[model samples]
Target: MILSLLGRLGRLWIVPVALAVWELAAREARAVYFPPPSGIALHVYELWFSGPPARLFLTDDAVAHILPSLGRLLLGWSAACLLGVVAGVALGRSARLSQYLSPLIHFARSLPPPVLLPVFLVLVGVGTPLQLAGIVFGVVWPVLINSIDGARYIDRQYLDTAQVFGLSRRERLTRVILPAAAPKIFAGLRLSVALALIMMIISELLGSTEGVGYRLLIAQSQLDILTMWAATLLLGVLGILFNAAFLAVERRVLGWHRAAL
Candidate 1:
């Protein structure tokens, strides 16, 4: 246990060390675009803990910025997960439906979410709705595709047994199909979480008045390198936290799958 703890601690140091080296190199090279780690850390600390001279959001604090972004991410991701799983299950279970929708799904998936930002902006007028829409659009495909594949691959023997027992359609689906497809669905959801974060940032960068991305843009415009770096660091932290939480949930929910693995 001690060795495992030490190994984890050592692994954590790797990124900080690599970052330190990068900062030193950038400083030695005297690149205006590249700031050192210490400078970035200072900026992050101030932005998160202190307020700027002018207060835009309530409390003029870091939590203000982070909460909005997190809220959007949650709302959008939840919508995508619910809709994607339903649609994927439908398509996966029905060959005729899958064939009918194949071209449409493929076409939509081919287009990048950024390409639709202008349309969303025009229709939704650059508020929470637009942000949510963009995130949902961006993340739904991976989840939908994965769910379809997972559901389609359900064991024929299981289905045969369920049918022989004269199970109701809903019972068979809830007890058998969904459980079998859950791991794949969860995998897709995990991937979607990352994508959702990226989409949220991108949308905020484009025209959002608030969020970590928006604050980063403001810092850049004001030439506040430290604050920019701080925002970047916060984003990294958020991603790591989100992934860890997701993995915990997956492990608890899918404990039965451990033996299979």
Candidate 2:
């Protein structure tokens, strides 16, 4: 147990070491734009965690900036996953439909998402709707393409066995096809989550009034380097927490697959 704990701490040693180095360097340099890590940490706490413990320990600033971004992230990711998986499965199952849509899908995926931001702004206006559009557009392709590939390439024997067992279409899909495709689906989900977070921040950076990205932009505009770093640190922490939670869910859902492997 002690060795396991030490191993974990050893693995994470770089983080603290890097922070300590930065702190020392910044103190020695005394540059106005490059505040020490301690300053950044203090600012982050004051800006986000100064509230009472009962309210999730979130300050008003945290509520305003963090909550909205998180909400948008969830909404966009859920929508993208639902639409992507459904469309991907349909396309994969229908060769004719896949062939028909191939050109359009390739074309759409080729375009970078930032290019669509202006179009979204014009069509959806500047706010949550626009942000959701950007996030969905940017992140959907990975899940859709991964799901398509997974479903299309299933073992022929599985289908033969399902047919021999007289399984209905729904039963075959739920039990055989989806189960086989679970690993690929989880891979796409992980990629989509990261992309969703990135797109959410990008969407907030432009034509938005409230969000973590917006606050970071404000700090930059006001030349508050310490606050900017604090906001950035907060973003990094949020990403880490999100990924950890996502991994936990993935482990639970894919436990059978892991055991099989």
TM-score of each: 0.88, 0.95
lDDT of 2 by residue, 83-150 (tens): 89989888888889999998898888788878898899999888999899999999888888888888
Candidate 2 clash pair list: none
State the TM-score for model 2.
Answer: 0.95
lDDT of 1 by residue, 1-261 (tens): 999999989889978889879888988988777878777777666656555446533345666688899999999999999999999998899988998998898898888878988889899987788899999999999899889988999999999999999999999999999999999999999999898999999899987889888998998899977777788888998899999999999999999988688
lDDT of each: 0.88, 0.90
Candidate 1 Cα RMSD (Å) = 3.5
Shift in Å, residue 255, candidate 1: 3.2
What candidate 2 gets wrong by more than 4 Å, as runs, is none
Among all windows of 10 consecutive residues in model 1, the one with the lowest summed lDDT is: 51-60
Candidate 2: worst-modelled 10 consecutive residues by lDDT: 105-114
As a whole number from 0 to 100, the lDDT of residue 90 in candidate 1 is 86
List residue ranges in candidate 1 displaced over 4 A.
11-13, 23-32, 50-59
